[model samples]
Structure formats: structure tokens, C-alpha cells
Target: MHHTARKFSLSVTAILASLLVTLSPHTFAAVGSLDLTTSGIGYFSLVLFVIAYLLVMGEELLHLRKSKPVLVAAGIIWMLLGWVYTQEGMPHEAEHAFRHTLLEFAELMLFLLVAMTYINAMDERNVFDALRAWMIRKGFNYKTLFWLTGFLAFFISPIADNLTTALLMCAVIMKVGGEDKKFINICCINVVVAANAGGAFSPFGDITTLMVWQAGIIPFQDFFALFIPSLVNFGVPAVIMSFFIENKKPDALDEAVEMKRGAMRILALFLLTIVTAVSCHTFLHLPPVLGMMTGLGYLQFFGFFLRKTLPGSLARKRAIAESRGDQAALRRLGDVVPFDVFSKIARSEWDTLLFFYGVVMCVGGLGFMGYLALMSEVLYTGMGATVTNIILGVVSAVIDNIPVMFAVLTMQPDMSTGDWLLITLTAGVGGSMLSIGSAAGVALMGQARGMYTFIGHLKWAPVIALGYAASIAVHLWINADLFVK
Candidate 1:
């Protein structure tokens, strides 16, 4: 399946490349580059983008990595655009636009890299595993675990990211759910909603919010304003789903799992890193990536400390275990390994990071070609800010929010800070309405597989839609003051 998909992707790229080369010079002459948005090249570029995105959307079924299609599309789109500009005697414009887009991608890439590394480090240190084990040992009833996992997803996502939060909480649900498909379905839906909602109110939560923050559209502290609306979004669907959970408890497990040494310290360092990033951005007027990179340094040094102490730590643990005659302790101690920061960095989500690069560049290329201007005039100008922003949220459910938000940022629409926040909130939480809408949802579907399918999620879509609409209303009402110029 993988090889077939790769061959298919290469074939598509070759065909598109051939078409672009054959058509470019003639198309440029006919359209004359005066209005690239409606030019032959513009239409061709749009078609190429659509083809790329269609491949991206079909990633699950096609067994192809989402990054492949878009990366190829980006290269082809830019190559055509650059060729047109050179013919028009304006090569510098294309150069400047491409460089600007690259710069934007670089900042976002580095920021996400640091964040993913921290998440990977904590995973290595058994932080998430410990949390999972604790939840399983508690043996909470289905209803209690339902709300517990949902609430944890909400709060944790603002810091840990919705995708990771959902995956972790879904693990707990799958363990406790056993053979109950009903329980798995409802709980998975709840986690997706809660994780997305939680992320809506924090800059660190979702990529959309992070983009809004990095673009200077909203201040970091101002994001907390969405907390109530975000809570309402999760709460509405959760209340509806709670009654569906059976009032039974899973059998308890006696497994005792312990975190590796330095887990707590690594967790603390992550928090400190977040603080450092926020401070540098807020107080020092520096890019937040600078602070995040610095935080990576902290982890590196701490990892060095752990590596240096591992031999002695192991010796002491062996001595204590031998004295106490605890074979289990000695056996566990044997499993202890040196913590390598570089290994954690390597394990970060390279696919997602690379996908971001593709989306950024592709959207950036379209914006450079004038699609964003056309879009802005039609969406924000023709429809009004409030209606347009709300529509954007719905749009996010089908198309990934990263490109949608990137296009919006590139368009640089004129609107109040409140309107900006509205778009940010909508884009962040809107993906909850569908099973494939958000990363959290898509991930949970995979994690819970046969038990939690798209059809199962669709059954609850109306309920999720209610929460989506309610969230918008709550945002408009609660943040009314910001909307007033």
C-alpha cells in the first residue's frame, strides 16, 4: 500500500510538472501577468493547489504521507510563479515574496520543533505513562472517567497540545471501556471536543492560536479571554454525551508503574521553558522561538546531568534493593537507561512538522499569486467580519485549519482585535464538529479504531454542532467589549 501510494504520488507530480512546463510561456503571454488572480497561471495554480489538498485529505485511505503531495505541489507552484515573474521583468517580486514566506515557515517550524521536543522528552521520562497508569489504577466508574478524561483533556491541551492530550486521554478510555463500543465512542468524542476547546483559549494550545499569537494579532494573555466560551463549547456536548455512558466501572488493575528519574524535573523545565518563551515575547519584544530554543538548552544540560549520574544512581539503587531483598525493585532498576536529549529531539513528529512546511509554502504561494486578496475581498469584504469569521470555523472542519489560518494571516484583513480573536477561536475549536475535523479527532479515531469510527462520531454531530454554535454566541456576548471600537 505504501509503495503504491508513493508511485501514485510520483506519477501525479510528473504529470503536473510536465503540464506546467508546457503551458507556462504561452499562458503567461496570453494572461500578461497584469491580474494574476484571474490569469491562466492563476487558475492553473489554483487547480494544482486543489489537487494537492485532495491528496492531503485522502491521506488516511491512500496510505500516503500527507506531506508528499503538498511539498511537490509547493515546488511546482513556485517554479511556475517564478518563471512568470522573470518573464514579466519582475523577478525581484517573486524573490521577495518567496523569502518572506520561507521566513514565516522557519519561525513557526523552530517554535513547533522546541515544543515537540519537550513533549517527546516528557514521554521518554514516563510522565504521560505515569499519568495513564494512575488513571487506570483509580478504577473510576465510566461516567466519572468520562468527565475526568474530558476535563483533563481540556486543561492539559492548553499546555500539551490537543492531539497529544486527546491521544493520552483516549488511552485511558480504551483501557476502561473494555468491550463497550458505546462508552468508547462517546468518551472519544468528548475528549476531542474538550481538547480542542481547551486549546482554543491558550496560545500554546492549537496551531491556529499559536499562529494568531506569532502574527501579533493577539497578545498571549488576551487568549485567556476565550476560556468561558471554550468551556461552554466542551461542556454543552459533554452534558449530552454523559447520559449515554453506562453506569458501570472497569475492573481495577494492580500494576504499579513508576516514572524514570528526572521525570519531575523535566516536566518543571518544560513549564519554565513556556514561561521563558512568553516572557521574551511579551516583555523583550523578541520572537517566542528564541525563548523556546533557549528552553531546549535547559533540557540538553539537564539530560547531561542525568547521563553523568546514571552509573552512580544505578549502583545506589542496586545496593538498596539488595539490602531490602526486593527483587522487583532490582529488576526494574536493570531497565533504567541513560536519558539522551538528542534521542528525544529525533523522535519529535517529523511528519507533522514537514506537513506544516508544505502547507505554509503552498498557501504562501497562493497568497503571492493573489488568491488570498480575492478571498479576502469576497469573504471578509463581501460577507462582513462576524459572518465571515464564523464561516471560516465551519470551513476548518473540512480543510485543515493550518492552511486556512495561514491564508487568513497572509490576507491581513482589516478588522477589530475582537474580530481577530473570533476567527482565532472559531478556527481552533471548529474542527470538533466532525471526526476528521481536528487532529485530536483524527488521532482518536486511529487510537480507538473499530470502536470509534467516523459514522459513530457523525451520530453525535448535531450535539457537537450545538456546542459549536453555542461557543460562537458565547464568544460574541462575553467579549462584546473588545468588539466595540
Candidate 2:
């Protein structure tokens, strides 16, 4: 199935590439440099933005040929090259600047690769399944468990990431929560909302925050000043969502019999992966991807250890062996691995990752188009830095926040400590506005299905919008004069 998907993707890419080549010179040459003073850069920007979004959406929504989107990327690149030339047009004095862009792009590519590998490796170890079962065993009744899972996804995402955290929580929800789909939906929504919200206030959380911090648009550690506001954004909705849920009592717990203590030991492995990645980023100034790849390399050693000793699995087996009544036929199914598990985990929603890559690269291409450069100069330079921060937050809610954050990072405006805090608050929490507004929100829909549907999220849009306002208000109230001088 994966190979088939790959083939289809390639085929689609070919068709898109052909169309771009045929359409390129005319469409792109005519585009020239867009002037916001006229029909507005927003128009051209929207065109570029929608095309990129269509490629992603088409890839997800339609089952076409293999490598289909790869071709689309080529055509878009053709358009981008023309726009880049017309807009930025080199330094004019024959200077070499491509090196810098490529360097930045490489770092991002690495980050994506490492993140993917780490997630796959962790799943191979069944770490997430263990975590969910433990939660169920702890007697966290439905409501508490619901909130607890989301809160964990929230905090863990800052370190683990929104996609990885959401995917992991989904497995647990599927296993213990039964076939009632709404449970999956609700759990997913809360998890994503919390994840992005928690991620907003931390430099370590979310790729977008890292991009902004790395560019020095915001100082490290100052992001937490937005924490109170960030909490308001997440806390308000979570409270509202809770009011709608039917709370039920938890099953009683027996004695504190541990689920293999060794499962906890894997936390050390997880830490090692993170530490390795961070060190590479800090010490060598390498892209986060290299670190993730290095961690993937380390997980191979972990696999050897797993083969040597199965911890929780062995005990669970022994107890099954001890049971006398209906042992024979049931034991076979229980002990043997289900093919469904293989397909589910193997077919984990990976297109989302590729979609992210395309969206970012296109956004980078749009940045090449110069209107963004103009925005920095006119809007940012004229309005003063604080309003720029607010505009950026609003922009993120309407567009893919990642690129907006990236553009803000690339521009590298001189901002007050308080102003920087506002960027953190909005870019992180602002994405809750539409389902596609944030990665966590988007992934939750795919991972959990009906619960976090776009309309469902849209229903809460007004509330999240209010939360967005409240969060900014909190930031201004708390950090007001730091904005002044």
C-alpha cells in the first residue's frame, strides 16, 4: 500500500510539473513584482498560498498516482524562481546569497527528518500504548482522563511535539476507550488545543516557535511572559468542552501493581534522544534533523535490548498462561500480533509531514517574492514593533502560522522583551481559529476523526477568537511598559 501510494504521488508530481512548465513563463512573467499599494500583495500572496494549499489538500483528499505532488512542487518552484528573481533579484552587485538560504533550508529539512524517525522509532517500542494503559489502570474516570491526556499532550508537545504527542494519545484512546468515535474526537480536540497552547509559551515547543527564537525575533526564556495569556486561550475552551461532556465515575483500582518498571526506563531513552538533538543544535549549530537522525541511530541499540528481554509483555503472558477457563483459543489471539496493528501503525498519517514541508518551502518562496519584505519595511517599520506583533498573530490565524512565523523570523525586527512575548502568545495559540490554523489542530482531525472536525472547530471559532483577544490583553496588561523603552 505504501509503495502504491508512493507511485501515485510520483505520477501526480509528473502531471503537475508538466502543467507548470507549459504555464510557467506566461503566468509567472506576467506576475512580475506584486505591489500591495495597488491590487495588493495580499492578492498574489493568496494565489501562491492557495496553490500550495491545494497541492497539500489534493494529496490528502484524492487518491491519485504515485509521486504526483513531487511534480507539483517542481511547477511551483518554477513559478517561485520567476517571482524570486523579479522581487528580490539578487543583491544586484553580484554577491552570493543563495548559500545562506540553502543553509537555513537544510536545517529545517533535518528537523523534519529527525522528528519523523524519532516518532517511528518510539512507536516500534510500544511506548505510547504503555502510557495509555497505565492511565486507564490508574482509574482516571472518563472526564479526568480526558483532561489529563490533553494536559499531558500539551506539556509533552513542547518537548515531544504536537504531531507525535497527538498520534501517541490516539493509540491509547483507541485501545481503552472502546469504539465510541466521539471519545476519540473529544480527546483529540482537547489534546491539540492544549498542545498548541502549551507549545506557544515555550521555545522548545513547536517548529514555529523555534524558527522565531532562532532568528532572535524573540529572546529565549522571555516567551513564558505570554504563558498566562496562552493558558487563557487553552483553558477557556477546555472548560467549555468539558461542560458538554457527560462525566462518569472511574472503575475502582486494585493495589498498585506496577506495569513493568522497565517501561519507565524508556523515559531515559527518550531523554537521551532529546538531549542528543539539542546538543547538536547548540554545540555544533547543526539542524535539529541531524540530532533526530542520530537518535534514530541510537534506537537500533534499544531494539537489541528489547529483543533480549521483553519486560511488561512477559508478565502479561505469564498471567495469561495461569488462567484456566477459556485459555486455549483465546490465548492464541491474545498472544499473536494482530495484522490490524501492523497496518494501523504502518499507515500512520505521514502525508501531513510532507504537506508541512511543501507549505513551508512555498512560504519561503513567497518571502522571496518581496511583498513580505515590503510588509516588514512599511507595516512593521511604520507602525512600530508592538502592533507588528499583533498583526503577525492575526496573520497566523488566517494563514499557515508556520510561514508567518518564519517570515517574522527572517525579517529579524528589533523588538522589546514584552513585544517578543506577544509574538509567542499569538503564533502559538492563534492557530486554534480554524482547523487548519495550526499543526496540532490539523493532525488531531486526521488522527481522531469526527471529534476534531473542521466545522466542530469552526463552531468554537468565536470562543477561540475571544480567547486570542484575552490572551493578548493579558500580555499587554502584564508586560505593558516593557514595550515602551
Candidate 3:
């Protein structure tokens, strides 16, 4: 703890330096602020991301207390970088810049909110809450239940974020594994990896993918190209983990039907939310979040109506009913509606939001320094080849892929179908490297403590590592013709 205040001051200094560059756009030697064509801003932003990642990892590694000042200071660094550098006294575009930043944060928040909402909503139905009870009744041995639970998480994550998916699956996992800490840790590890890898391909699967789609970095159709590779992403990890996971027998199902009319109600709402989200994007040109917000609003309205229309006892009974309905199931979905769950979802450790804000502002800051814009021009000119573009896309996963993709998308270079596919695949799966690599992975660790330990994760990184590497190989090989052309 020596010179603790000094360390904080030093962190603040980096932000100020970045902010100064952002605020003074004219100072950029290249055209506009931060050389988009060729300069240091992108790399500088990478530096910031790394520092932030390290600090976060340190806190997690050491089990530090909640440090608001640390978070606040970091956020300031990111904000100033954008407000000062990117906007650069360009009063006319200030609104656009601010709006874009908000949109970015909202996109991040939307993922968390939706995941939280769905999981809590599911819990409300007494859905996953019955894992232990169901497992007990099944009479399956611990070993058999462990593998079954992992498989369940693996498949569920395509719809659920890895964290929520992992959490949902973990209820069964922990119950089956009992007090075997090592087995429990491995099971959680498998869930996290599967959920994250599964989430890589679809726009709705992961926030980064959603950002890419919504920002038009990759069109909707282009996203599905990762489908084959995403399977590999999940499959590879499952296979490796399976090698470690000895197979067990199946558990029996007991008659514990809490099914009521509310299950149908929940299903209806889930479908409605999905329908509205797609419709808004397809017809209204609304971003996913706006549509989700609309759906959430409607859910609330529906709840109010139910409270009024349904008589007291009948409503209570149905609301408490368990079922095969979606997590958005009304009545039993306690986790989503309860005040605490809602708050937790809304406030789910949004350091990354601030991190994104920092990246946006920091990238803008480089423009002020004549660093980013120039670099952009250079990259666009140099990496015009399809192969090169794919290479860059793969590299993007190592750092925050958002800025690179944004920069590339803005350049609006002539790229082909396959090259764009490569971008989607690489950027999507690249985050499997470390826990801090992806938002969902990080959130899963916090949400499921003891179950999915960070060190335990490092133990099994090879599973996902092979997945990531092999998927890229598959992407390259499958699209060989396009790359060659």
C-alpha cells in the first residue's frame, strides 16, 4: 500500500494527457484530429485498455474491496479522452459525439440488462431455482449430472450471454457436483467457455457482435457466416473439457410440475419481446436496445394489467407456477422483477462502459494529436487486400476490437463477402484469450464466485485456446477461394 495515492495520481495523469490531446484537435499534424490514416491513437487506446485490464485483474486477483475512486478516476480518463480529443471544440458535432458515446454505453448496458432481465425473469418462474430439487429427484450420480449440466450451459448460451447462461447451468452443476470444489470449478469453467464461445457468432449472441451489427460494421447476413466456426468454438472446448470430464449416467425426472397458466404467459411475453426487437430493427431502423426497452416497458404494462385483471388468489397461484416457458415468464419470474435483481442487472459492473467511453474519447483524442486519422488513412491504403483485412480483423480480437472495426467500417474499403465473414468470426471469438478479454466472461466470474474461479479458468484456457485457433483455421480454409481471389 505504499504510495497508494501516488499510483492514483499517476493513473489520473495518463487520462489528462490523453484529454489534452482530445480537446485540441487542431494540434494534430495530420488532417483533422488523430491521424485516422496513420498515427499512435489506436495503439495508445490499447495501452489504456491494458492498464485498465491490469488494474481490474489486480483487484480481482487480490480480492480488493469496492473502490469507487479507482473506477471514477478511470472513467474520467476515458471520458476526457473523448470529450476533449474526439470532439476537439467541434461544437457542431458535439451532439453526435455525445450521442454515439451514449449509444455505445447503452449497447453495453442493453446486453447486461437483457441477460439480467431474462435470468431473473426465469428465476421468477422458479425455473432454474429447481435445479437441486430436480437433480435430487432424478437420482443421477454426481459425475453424470456434472457433464449433463455442462452440456445444458453449452447449448443455452446462444440465446443467453455466457454469464447468465453459465449461472443458469451452474445451479444444476453445483448441486450435482456437491462439495467437490475442483469438480465444481471445472464445471463452471466449462460453462463459461461454452457460453462465451457460443455467443461469438450471432448479433444477438454477444454485445461485441451486436455492436458490430448495429454499427453496420458487419451487415446482419454477414454475421451468420460465423455459424460454422462458432460451432467449432463451442465444440472444441467441449471436446477438451470432456476429455477431462468423465462421463456419467443420466438422472431421473420426478413429478414436480409447478406449471400453471403463467408459463404460457411468460412464453407469450418472450416471443413478443423478440418480435418487437426484430421488428424495430427491421422496420423502424431502431437499435436493439430501443426495441428491448420498448419490450421491457410492455412487459411492465402487462404485469400491471395482470395485477388488475386477475383475482388475488388465482393470480398468486399462477404467478408462483413453474414451467417450460421462457425466463420472461410472468408471475414466477422473481429475479427480474424484484427491485434488487433489477438494480443489480442495471448496475452490473459497467467498468467496460466507461472503458468503451474511454476508447471512444481516446480514439478521438488521437485525432487531436494527428495520430489516429493518419494511421487510419495508412491502414486503409495498405491493408486493401482481402487477406490482409482478415488478418487485421483477427488481430483486432486481442485488443478492443470495436475501434478497429469502427475505423475499418468508416474507411468503407472495397471488401468481399468472405473477408467480411472473416472479420465477424475473428472479432467475435478473439476474446477467449483471457477473462478480461470479454465482457461476458468477466461478468460471469463476478456473478458466479467460487464456482468459476479465475485461476480455475486459466487451468482450462487451452480448451478455448484450441477452439479460437481452430476456428480461424476453419474460417480461412473454408473461405480459401475468396481469400485467394
The candidate that achieves the highest lDDT relative to the unseen native structure: 1
Model 1, C-alpha of 120: deviation from truth (Å) = 0.6
Q: What tens digits encode model 1's per-residue C-alpha lDDT throughout 310-349? A: 9999999899999999999999988888888776555544
The residue-level lDDT of candidate 3 at 425 comes to 64
The digit string of per-residue lDDT tens for model 2 on 32-89 reads: 2433323444455557566656655565557653134533653465454554445665
Whose TM-score is greatest here?
1
Q: Candidate 2's error at 260, in angstroms? A: 9.1
The candidate 1 region of ten consecutive residues with least summed lDDT is 20-29
lDDT of each: 0.78, 0.57, 0.53
- TM-score, candidate 1, is 0.92
| CA displacement after TM-score superposition, residue 1 of candidate 2 (Å) | 19
State the lDDT of candidate 3 residue by residue for 83-135, as single tens digits: 54545665534345445544454454553355445444544455544544665
Preferred candidate (lDDT higher): 1 or 2: 1
* Preferred candidate (TM-score higher): 2 or 3: 2
* Count: clashes, candidate 3: 44
